[model samples]
Target: MEASKVIHAIYTDDDVLMSAVKTVKAEKYHIEEIYTPFPVHGLDKAMGLAPTRLAITAFLYGCVGITVATVMMNFIMIQDWPQDIGGKPSFSYLENMPAFVPIMFELTVFFAAHLMVITFYLRSRMWPFKKAENPDPRTTDDHFLMEIAVHNNEESLTNLLKNTGAVEINIVNKDEDAH
Candidate 1:
């Protein structure tokens, strides 16, 4: 089921949120989601999220850009439309490559930036004009929220949440009677 259907508990304090997450994890509850306004120290580890590979992708994109730019410049200035203006050989591409530095640098940055953005969007399940499925608006502010699926353990989960210092508690179900 989608995480939006479960009850979400919001916290104003990071310490409280972290403790609650730890407690819930200890109990082996299925954590549906967590949201925070900013990166919390060590929160990724607490959430058990794996490390990202954006750096590797960026490096590969940069290489592709450089290769494309080099090939295009060589083909255009040396092979396709060779011109000898300064008594230099038309085939001397290696010596004349300094003139192509600007294009090469620009393409490298352009490819790296564009590819990294696309990768992040795809990884985060976001798209242009797509309505975000954020769990709670307060999570974009100073609040942190943690959501867990009750399954057959609502009572124990509530007790665990309260014990972990939740400022407010609300039980929710997607179907009727969850309200």
Candidate 2:
């Protein structure tokens, strides 16, 4: 059986799309998704999406990278192979920390960036070479598509979308993995 019917409301401009989202939200309609050619600032907040925890995870990843760099540097330069800097030997890890600063900083940035990308992909359920959940191809080029589920109020939702300056509105059966 079909999952349910959904409305695909297309807009030509980002501003119009944002306003339409607000209007639909004001009408208490649940927005399944919004597709755009590029990022639309504040759209997630407008859609009432909770703030992401990715930043926190990135910070934690950075700390891990720094910790690994510290341990590796300590073992290599201080414990195993001692080096002389200026007039002091690498017996003290703290004293030799300046030389390892570059490695620590690089590892921190590296972990934060790479791990954040992977986390984002996993959280969003986006995978390379996977079938895209996008309903309209125009959303990839120049249009914005707002998908809203119909809860026995298709007529009201249709009229609401029409009033919100939607250029094209289509009613489509929900795809199995469109969510």
Best by TM-score: 2
TM-score, one value per model? 0.82, 0.93
RMSD of each: 3.4, 1.9
Cα displacement (Å) at residue 55, model 2:
0.7
lDDT of 1 by residue, 46-115 (tens): 7777788999999999999999999998999899999886887767778888778999999999999999
lDDT score of model 2?
0.90
- Least lDDT summed over 10 consecutive residues: which range in candidate 2? 170-179
| Candidate 2 lDDT, 108-148, residue by residue in tens | 99988999999999988999888877788899999999989
The C-alpha local distance difference test score for the whole of candidate 1 amounts to: 0.81
